[model samples]
Target: MTEVLQDLAEYIEQKRSDCVISWGFTNGELNISVAPSNITSFVEFLRSDSRCKFSTLVDITGVDYPDRTKRFDVVYHLLSMYQNHRIRLKVSIRESEAIHSIVSVHPSANWFEREVFDMFGILFRDHPDLRRILTDYGFQGFPLRKDFPTTGYNEVRYDEVQKKVVYEPVSLTQEYRQFDFMSPWEGAEYIISDDEAEGSKLMDGSKGFKDTLTSEQKIRNFNINFGPQHPAAHGVLRLVLELDGEIVERCDPHIGLLHRGTEKLMESRTYLQNLPYFDRLDYVAPMNQEHAWCLAIEKLTKVNVPRRASLIRVLYSEIGRILNHLLNVTTQAMDVGALTPPLWGFEEREKLMVFYERACGARLHAAYFRPGGVHQDLPDDLLKDIANWAEEFPAVLQDIDELLTENRIFKQRNVDIGIVSEDDIQKFGFSGVMVRGSGLAWDLRRAQPYECYDEFDFKVPIGKNGDCYDRYLVRMEEMRQSLSIIKQAIQKLLDEPGDILARGKITPPKRAEMKGSMEALIHHFKLYTEGFHVPEGEIYACVEAPKGEFGVYLVSDGSNKPYRAKLRAPGYLHLQAMDHMASGHQLADVAAIIGTMDIVFGEIDR
Candidate 1:
């Protein structure tokens, strides 16, 4: 694979000599640095070339290197389905510059470019609908920029007299802390000074639809707010739908209400502390998110996981897969007027939550999956409980399968609704079940194979029709496959008895050992306060997260803290396709589409 990537990199350089600046491999993935002006042509070559069919646009994120000559780096992660290879393309530009948008080549670039503009104030030329994405409407500053204060410039609240949401200058005072740390991105010190903070306060210049259009023009297309409070909408997911009486003309999802800047927050904290933050993103499958972060760190540090820990991580990840699918498929059933599925499914979810609580002492946010391995090893009794659950879990799945698979009402609501064609797969940068639901068997576990996944034998489910029902069916089959994987991991866990965590500077000494030995105690103290430094490099690591491909684009400048940690959340892409999917459907079908896509605002807004 390494030689093939190198040869391909040389071929690319030889083919497009003007566009290519540098090409090399980082963490076994090919990375090409291209000129900002020629990135569109370079991307076109990579996508359309027969040998380099990098069709899927995985993610686009902006990395702010404040002190550098070129202040911002726009990164594009692309995956080649035909070749089973991935590439990262970068274009470095100054603060005032703009890059050509590749929406003409790959429609997936539309939302990705919008997010880059929203987070870092990076402009994209020729983007049809480029505007604020993961921020408040008319948001004052770019939150992800290095100069921006963590406590953003503007905030919104519901005033008593106004009775509607109102935006105002942020009132909170955050005292600066000077840590005397030099970050290439965050300038010479850890604390951002007031002058530097002022640089990030440029308000977005885009006008709202009502302000831009005349009353006569507005009457042709009626715009209505879908929610922040509507029972049908997902939590705080508000959309501006341009309706033509019964049919939706356009669906503009007004997200960012839950935007917490998880990536920016990761830069301030040590890698150890950052693991828990991933849990908050996809709270439905907390451990799976942690697994991706841990993998990135483990890959950078070159810390080898013990066989026992590898199996344990796989076990928990599969459990997360089942948890996410159950919540999505069941809630989707409820969205279409069935009440019984949620009732029956929640019972199974409770059973899984018990396993989480038993393992990590937290049912919801089990920050147990760490960089070296899990926080601890699973006991024999807990393994027995898991094994017991594995056997009995399928009966509940069978009951739900029987109830909804061929049910008259269930099929009518989902069968051909919210159809996503095979071409729509690459256009929306779909992954996990969303890609599978569209008849593409593209799974990171099988395609990329992280952790101990390569050792497991499992079948990837493919959907026949790319509709709401096909997605539901994919999730259902996925749960069963996950259950099979869990059982296999448990068998391997019972057989392999060794260190569950890695033994090195990366992994901490056990609490019992810390009390006995002075070396252990000192090592434990230093490990938590000032974490071990990772050798300088950048790596894009991903796991087949419950909803889709959850990735961490981690950059380390030889520091205990990450320079930048951009999370490539699958929900964000799924949410981006709402406009395309729901534009022709009725108003009520919006909820069904949202549920089928498994649109969790935790990861989406993060």
Candidate 2:
């Protein structure tokens, strides 16, 4: 690790020829954070420098710190495709200013930078067509900043004449948004009540409301709202597209309509309490989401899961991956006018969900994973069932291939639609099938092995065209790979029979005597009421989820609840590439492009 960092420092020094601000590693990966002014040169050097040919931009996200000297920090994660090394670049800027945009270096940074600008109010200098990418147009203030009110600045009224919604600024004299770090119910003070706003209206008539923009005024160049309702969109995501005929001049995705402020909510709940919320983040694959969070907490607390538990986690996670990818591909096919594939995909997925039910006792929102270990051990019958399904899944795959792989209409509609190049994948810091479809052999499970993935022998599939068809083919192949992993995991489980839950802090009392013994009852009550405390530290845990590298970066300050929890969702990155993919394509291909990206709005909105 020291040698790797030393080599990285030398690489950064050589690349930055002019000024190398700082270079180091955090949480085991190399990081070279440069000044805002030196960003372009630094990126160019990193891209061209043979030693550190960082060919892919993994992610670009903004962090707000109103109390700090540097008000905001824009972070970029870069990956070296050849070396299989990762680096993080952080550029700090004051609230009053904007930093130079890296979109020119990586076009996928375009939407990501726009998202920063939209949520945190960090301006990206020279960002071509920088606008609100997540929030609605005419949004009053940056939502992610510490000072920004959780409920937003004011109430918005629809202007019939203008055909748009307008925001009316309210008084800054009101109390700050109160967030309780103890429990979700205790955080009621932070919530905005309709009665309070209405009472304020009675006092001043116009004190709380302000007109920002009307629909007619906001509309330009063939603008249309895709959905806060359209089924083609996976969830309640609304996209306002500005088109010049069939060409998308500007594409702005309005998220947060389904905003439950999940991170904020999690910060108020105990580590155990937060597990259920992960299920909500990516409802389609709750197991993957829960596993990512569990891994993050487990890493921070230095808890070693038992061999049996690790194998069970892997088995469940792989099943979830297959289920998620199947649904995504099937739905995407349906969106592109191929209806039969979705039914075929769902049928297989339902079978997997049945297995999940046998294992976790729940299908969609399985709170199966817990810190230190899992909630319970897999039953012998369930194990046999999963093994049977694993054996039979290949036949189902062959049937799916026969149905869609050679179908002329499916091929014609998806072949060249939504072509995301290797450059775009790198720029957007895309992962999973999106990156694989672009020909990059980067997978978190392989690149940074977690759980018992290193023990499993499986292949990471890659695509050539970076098109929708490639994404479909890659996911189809991935399902088979996942089945192979599951089979291996089942074998391991049979070989290792032991306690599924670790015997230490945070372990639940045995169920056998809870009802009869007062001591066990009291223990259970204490565990649920107070929750286990974690050491003061932060850790970022990631897994190769079906959508992409679903990561949970958690900060724990020796509290029952988290200090802060951020989900590094891959769907957000894929959504950012929508414009680039659908720019010149026909309007009808928009659905095909969206389908190909396989974005679940739950992840995107969260």
lDDT of 1 by residue, 1-606 (tens): 999999999998999999999988888888899988898888888889998988899999889998898999999999988799989999999989989999988888988899899888889899999988776554566777777766445667789998999888764322222334455565554557787444323211122223355543222445678898876676788898878766898998878899887887888899898888988998998999999898999999999998899999999999989998898888889988999999999999999999999999999989999889888889999999999999999999999999899999889888888999878887888888888988888888998898889999999998988999999999999999999999899998888898889978888998899889999989988999998888899999999998889999999999999999988889888888899999888888888898898878889888
Residue 264's lDDT within candidate 1 is: 79
What C-alpha lDDT does candidate 1 achieve relative to the native structure?
0.86
Q: What are the lDDT figures for the candidates, one per model? A: 0.86, 0.78
Candidate 2 lDDT over residue span 1-606, tens digit each: 568867778867775656567777555555566787888778877887788888777667776666778777677777786787767777887778768887888876776777677767788788897887655434556656655544455867798989999887755632433332344444435555899766545433344333376423222245678997998877787777867667777667667677666766676689999899889888888888999988887887778998899999999889888988888878887886777878888888888888878877898889998987898888777888888988888888898889889989889989987887766766666778888997878888898798888999999999999888998999999999989999999888877799888766677777886878898888788889999898886566778888998887666779898866778888887887776777787777788888777788677777
Query: Judged by TM-score, which candidate is best?
Result: 1
Estimated TM-score for each candidate: 0.88, 0.82
TM-score of 2: 0.82
